[model samples]
Target chain A: MKLKIKDVEFKNPVLTASGTFGYGNELEDIIPVNELGGIVTKGISLKPRMGNPPPRLAETPCGLLNSIGLENIGLEKFVKEKWPEIKKIGPEIVVNIFGEKIEEYVEIAKTLEKEGIRCIELNLSCPNVEKGGLEFGRSERVVRNLVEKVRENFNGVIFVKLSPNFTDIVKISKAAEKGGADVLTLINTIMGMSIDAENMSFKIPRKVAGLSGPAIRPIALYIVYRVYQEVDIPIAGVGGINDIKSALEFHLAGSTLIQIGTALFIDPWIPFKIIKGIEEFLNKKNMEFKSIIGYLNKKRG
Target chain B: MRFLEEKSEIINLIDLGKDYYQIVISAPEISKLARPGQFVNIKVTGSLFPLLRRPFSIWSAKENYIEVLCKEVGIGTKILREKKFGKISLIGPLGKPFPEPSPEDIVVLLGGGTGIAPLSFYAERITENKKIFFAGFKHLPSPYLLRRLEEVCETLIIATEDGSMGFKGLLSELIEKEFKNIESEYTKYFVCGPYPMLKVFEKILPEQRTFVSLEGIMACGFGICMGCAVKKKGENRYLRTCTDGTLFSLKDIEI
Candidate 1:
């Protein structure tokens, strides 16, 4: 079954998250990316980011911690070199934009609008870096103001991705909705740190990092549920969702769509598998997925 | 891109001294397309940790099968070693292939430990040319691959630091000794090993005729992450080892 958000209509509801899918061309040799719902590219900024130093990643109990610091080649290089190949993948190419200032976001969004991107996932919640990520995301006023500024310049489906570290996610999501965001992507990585006890040192290059994968599923689902109750906009649920069961949890929690992130490191074919599984699950139960979007929340006592 | 659905089955597993093992997988589609010095990124079945694919150089490719030699160093290889027959997943013959040696060229192939995998593949392909192999290991003798090297090359020289195998010295020393014995000039040298060993070869060999395969911590294996970059010599730019090379001329890379 198809799902429509604003002007874009996805063939299904399974899409790859930003920074996990790597522009969609890297996995071409092994898997077919066109079979999935869509692909959200790695975060693009005004200038190229070299990212963090070596030891940028560490494996935790059941998840991964990354301080990648948004390593990308800037919007100019992306539009010139990466876009032509990405367009051929035959899925909606949603560009994830990150910026240090309000104007930077508006400028990038306006550029992307002219470039014909199907949607724009505003990255206001990345927790890996020292500046411009959680700093802007943590404040409800700043999040609303930035969303309003981008909405003023660009006319596209604005999906505001929210951070999980906030004390009240419902407040921040309400702020985004008031500022004219079309959809909300619940729960970016939670701020977490790991220490090397023997050497009394930080395990990663940056002492503190953002945690992802199965470890963040509980928190992600909680935020998705809370935001679902407060916001009227469609939600694109992400974080720690690796299988059809986890995906179904998001759908039942009132998320209109789902994005696969940390699971991409484990299995690039997971998004495709989850898409197939959802279809089969719907067929077997003889029910349409769209009818059950928020069915679990409705039965809650 | 054409996706080949050939399932690769484990044909044989042999421990080759220390923690290393030679795993031979039979995939006709991959073997038929695989060339020397190419690598395959393997996804270990049923592994929850180290949830990324591991890249291994193709040791040998024959009729309908290809072999990958790996050491149980981390969680990925540990799970791979425990896998029995009838397990199957994705197989890719990726990256650039090794350069072919000219008929008149005398090749000196140097390798250390598991790095000898691609060298053996190169030795097997250039059967008509004069080839000399210098292999190095830690303490124990690598009988599994040593025997295989002897069958393909004109001469095979072994070196161990603990005097456990052929020559009681390093492989670099053996290369120096062999260099003095050969009166005819060798056309090219192919070296693949640890960074330190590669650094040593980069210092001694002539830049114009030497090629080295570099090893870097790779994530996507297809030049996206920009993790496997080697600085170009005399320039500030870097080339991706996954796309530009796992093999590059010695002069092209800084170190």
Candidate 2:
């Protein structure tokens, strides 16, 4: 099950998505962290953010709407506290870095590089934050410029996590690749809103939030399939993956690696269950893991 | 810090009427370790209609069964109420427990509606401190819970808005009325209730002596989701209700 994206090696293709799995140490009481291919830390910025007020989460059908505002311990605390603990968890730790300014992104990258982090997932598509997240990715020029500067600062693997929100996703995918991304993590939460009928106020006080779960699976799949056809970099598929079938759907749609997100809330053991399911699936079909990736597009072509 | 996803059997589900139901499930390990004020996140059905698990304070736990009392307020609780048989997933014994009172101190347990759940568990477990419970509700509780609470506390006062039960006024009014005689530094108060009821207690109870249990809207009842944040008193940073507390001293929080 060994795989490589740039110089970083993965034991498997099942990683826990950022924000979904906190610090990778939260569920040690339930599941072993080493079983995962990697754990993506919550979005860390240059300064600590208190996040949004109460009523941050609202349930929508088979999905969830959240406006967490990217609350984190910031860079200094993450490296001093979280990094040491997460690094001890054994899986490849992919630090998800966020910045309000383009220069902030480069600066955080420089710190992680100095700290000897092997890979980083750039968070350019966090819908909950007021600035520097989705706003930075909303422009092709900004996405390209941001990633290019980050490339200069961090010498290790870089994954540009793109959003499924507004603007041209394919163009932005190309912009990330052109700017020297090692991998493209496809699809952050799509923007959504929920209204409490009786209360007559927004369920998530911000009036807008990011939606994840099986509800956004199709949207994520389309984005992955579309981007896989256009970009040369590997696609790390996420968004609403709850089961083995959905996991493989992303794999067939051209995701080289798949991330378990909102579904982990449903069951913490899901990622491990999926890892076992996929390995079993490949053996029963006698198919190579690489051959199955992008199988739909490959067959059609 | 240790909790597991247990497939607990539905020992029984009883409709207490008035849209409230009592569910008893078997989770021996979680039940034995569960303390007062600890809660569980229940995935009520196998289907996906109600996506996230609902958090319920342990109404009571004994032997192999953990029971929770809930109202059919929304989709998740309604699904839980409608469950006829079989097992539902439960992740439990979560959050910090209500602090135990010193033997010399007198314990005052205050609750409203389903907020009585954890306090019932608390009063049942106390063998040292003298326990007094003040419960208020819009309607009278099911006779089973009413009787159980009566037995657990040395003194129990019941109040309903419509005067259908014991006292004819609010529990706050009853407590304030009663405490005029017993108010002392030796009294340690623990409150569990809806936001409005908690707000009323926050005003009447001494902040330094009161501990309030808060049940905020939650996605994951564990710390992972970062969804259950309650603002800390006089601080810019927020505390995670899932890990930091389902219980906090009244002086330590905004509400």
Candidate 3:
């Protein structure tokens, strides 16, 4: 039920994905915040973001397309105005940071370090933004550079959230490892689009948006399985993780941690359900947590 | 107060005809939490195909039940129309409520099409004010809650674009004329409809005294997804429709 990446230890393997679990305060009344592994906050930037326009989300067949553009309280206000409220909830808060430029990411990281933040998730893979988000995540060189710069000033655990839009995810995973990432989260939402055939118009205002929910689970699992074989750093599997079965699939695919995204919208208390289900599954199998990780790739035959 | 996610069973699903329908569900917890101007996010099907919940403004809330006025506009709503009776998932009552009107104020509620849903609920809550309900329709809707709204309001007016049942013209035009004649000392306006009607009222009404309940395709009923972002008037930032408001001060928002 515990997971360790670099120096910090997670109480469980189940975490809430960034941009899905507000600032860990909205659902605190319903879901016990301190019980889960951790909670990654919605993506924050150096300055306050208003996000995209109306119609930022659209429902697709078995999925959701979103172009929220990472609306968040800027780093200054988050520390000054929001941090006290967030801290009171008592979870391992992983502040998810994004930037329009490399320097902006470093500035936010330095601010996080100053504020005594224990962990930070570098958002190199948000598809909603028009700036240097997904572009930095897919390119190996950019990923390495961004991570290296944040790693220089911030001593806390850094998780590099990567994009699934990449052609070779393993190469990107290696790039984060080479840049001294404590852990890597794979994968962010996959870029997809839907159209209104009768109107001949795109459903989302942004022609393409990140697709999440049950539709992207298989793709996330395949990427995690491939990257686990190639990288040494711990992997935080994300995308389409809703129930205990899907959580086990990630662990079997070699992920030490799993984060639930769009599913939180459906049920905010799902983390508790998933955590309890996992405990029962392990008990029935008469196995330990380690037995599940890398189990699929082990010498079974 | 926090919202609740409840398993509600369909108590009534009546076709109001012309593709419009009324869906009433038994959700005691949500009924207690619901206030006027707020909405509930309903999961149309208990399947994975339609991944997101459809948001509906509260039409009525009694002791242990809630009502939603719906029109079969798309695949999700179309599926919702077919369900006669069963259990479904609902998360609500989400968003801020309409501002309370003062005893001396004349509260004007303007609604178009299914937009009449929340205003009818609003009328039922205000007992100290002079309530006026203006409802507009494309054609004669089969059997809406006009009589119920009439009982709640001091006055009621119906307008139809095709001149089928009431005054012929855009509801906005009627609203403009009505506002000019009534010139009360303290007046508050609550309006909801298609975007175009909202935009028209934005120009006609005094921004400070008007509040508008807006709609957008939303994923989370809370603030997480930022799916319901509404542009702030004369400002660079956006306000979340689910958290900041489904009801926003007209002076603060663009439309």
Output the number of the lDDT-best candidate.
2
lDDT of 3 by residue, B1-255 (tens): 489889889899998878898998999999998999889998877877688788899998999999999989988788888887887899999988887887889988899988998999999998888888899989875644666667788798888899887788889988877777665668888889999999899988888888899887778888777787889889988888888888888999887
Ranking by DockQ: 2, 3, 1
Off by over 4 Å in 2: A126-134, A299-301
| Clashing residue pairs for model 1 | none
Write down the worst ten-residue block by lDDT for model 1 chain B.
B1-10
Q: What are the per-residue Cα lDDT tens digits for candidate 1 across A258-299?
A: 999877765667888899888898999899988767767653
Q: Using TM-score as the measure, name the better of candidate 1 and candidate 2.
A: 2
Candidate 2, B1-255: lDDT as tens digits = 878778888889888769878888899989988998999999988887788898999989999989898988998887777776777999988998887778898888899888889999999999898888989988877898788798889888899988998988888777778876656899888898888778888888889989989998888888899998998899998898888899899899997
TM-score against native, each model? 0.88, 0.97, 0.95
lDDT of 2 by residue, A1-301 (tens): 6789877899999999999998789887678889899998899999999999988999998999999999998999999988878888888999999887888889899999999899999988743244524577788888898899999888999999989677889999999999999889989988999999998988988999999999999999999999999888899999889989999999999999889999888788898889999999999999999989999975223
Question: How displaced is residue B71 in candidate 2, in Å?
Answer: 0.8
Local error of candidate 1 at A197, Å? 7.6
**Per-prediction fnat values?**
0.16, 0.87, 0.79
Better of 1 and 2 by DockQ: 2
Runs of candidate 3 with Cα error greater than 4 angstroms are A126-134, A298-301
* Cα-based lDDT for every prediction: 0.79, 0.88, 0.86
